[model samples]
Target: MIETIVFDVGETITRDDRYWASWADWLDIPRHTLSALVGAVVAQGRDNADALRLARPGIDVAAEYHAREAAGRGEHLDESDLYDDVRPALSSLRDLGTRVIIAGNQTSRAGELLRGLDLPADLVVTSGEWGVAKPQPEFFQRVLEVAQAAPRRTLYVGDHPVNDTFPAKAAGLRTAHIRRGPWGHLWADDPKVMEASDWRIDSLTQLTTLIEG
Candidate 1:
């Protein structure tokens, strides 16, 4: 039985529309342009942030993020940004006595905002808060530590094949590939992703059935 279900933040629990749109506005580029660039980078197995670099050559994304904050434009999250299924699915899992955790490659500020939403989760954390990011063995190690469960009993659900399914499987956690986000759809049929995932789900609601079954 799966005692713990850990989730990826972006494109898993929340929609990333605002995130990319915000960046497009910040860089004064068309939203479609940035979106295409992001998709291109993902297809090439490059960091999605490379889209920003492609938009404005030599632009330091880290420094620009600070500048945006200084100018009163920063990461923003609210209930509307969440996926429609997020609340019902997560709440249902918790109601079933499963441990629910939200962990992903997000900023510490994102972590704070997520916690503020008061979702029915046992813990919500981010790579920025933990000083490590996904695809790193250390990140999954920290996940295992926080979950306090045997790897085989903990399930990691995410959309990104490279960062989510592959690494979590390597860490011994059962992996579920959710077919939601762009990366999710783009690689859903890829051989490696199929090989790594123990389950393929279309929505968070499917998790409830998986756990109960």
Candidate 2:
């Protein structure tokens, strides 16, 4: 039986539309333009971190990210910031005596943001705090270690094919691909990636039934 449920934060539990749209406004660029650049970068198999550098000439991307992180501190994610199905699924999962965790590739301030939202997770882990990012086996190893979970009994839910589902499954954990995020939607019809996931859902609410069923 699955004892632990590990989740990807961005586009999985929380929607990043407002965050990225705010970034576009800060950069004085059209939101759609920024979105397209990010999508293009990902389409070419590049990291979203590379988008700013590729789109803007002579800008210090690392510093800019740090600045954004600093500015984003103490900011709370409102109910509208999360998907409609998130809270219900999380609550149901927790009530089932399952250990639910939110782990993702986010900045050091991720824990604070998660706390601000009052998510129904037992733990929150981020790449910045762990000093390693996802798709790297070490990160997933840390996740398992922190959760005190055996790989076989753990379930990882995320939208990333290469980053989230692929690696987690390879690590001996089951994976659920949520077809809502950029990576998920972009590779939705790709049999190679989609076939790797143990399960797939269009909405978070479906997770409850998936777990119960």
Candidate 3:
């Protein structure tokens, strides 16, 4: 039985359309162009941040990130920024005695952002704090350590096939492919990717039924 549930932050729990759109605007590039850049990186099996740096050579990423945060100061996510199904599903799982965690390959502000939302997770960890990112086995190992979880008894939920599903499955955690966001929907039609997931859902609300079953 799955006793632990771990989630991806961006687009998995928190909707990222506004965030990515803001980044595009800041870069003075079309949103689709930005999306394409990310897609290109994924296609080439490269890390997302590395691709962005390669795209804009000599870009002062730290400065750019701080600038973005500064420009959006005192701004935090509201309910509208989360998917309709997130809160209730997480609450339901926790109510059932399942340990819940948010472990994502995310920016430094991820923990702060989730804290501001008062999420129901028992623990929240980010790549910035872990010093490792997903698709890498060590990241999942750290997740298991921090979660105090057994890989075989844990379910890793996310939209990314490569970073979340594949790696988690490899690490012995069952995987849920939630096809609701850009990365999720982007690979939704890919049979190979979809087949790799242990469970697949169109919406997070379905998780209640799955877990209850």
Comparison by TM-score, 2 against 3, better one = 2
Runs off by more than 4 Å, candidate 1: none
User: Which whole-number lDDT from 0 to 100 does residue 93 have in model 1?
Assistant: 97
lDDT of 2 by residue, 50-112 (tens): 767666778786677667768863334678888888889999999888899998998777667
lDDT of 1 by residue, 26-112 (tens): 999999999999999988988899999999999999999999989989999999999999999999999999999999999999999
- Ten contiguous residues with the weakest lDDT in model 2: 68-77
Instruction: Give per-residue CA lDDT, model 3, range 29-70, as digits (tens).
Output: 788877778778766666666545765778887788888778
Task: List per-prediction Cα lDDT, in the order shown.
Answer: 0.95, 0.83, 0.81
Which RMSD does model 3 reach against the true structure?
A: 2.6
Q: What is the lDDT of candidate 1?
A: 0.95
For each predicted model, how many residue pairs clash, with residues at least 3 apart or on different chains?
Answer: 0, 0, 0
Identify the runs in model 3 with alpha carbons over 4 angstroms from their true place.
32-58, 70-76
Best by TM-score: 1
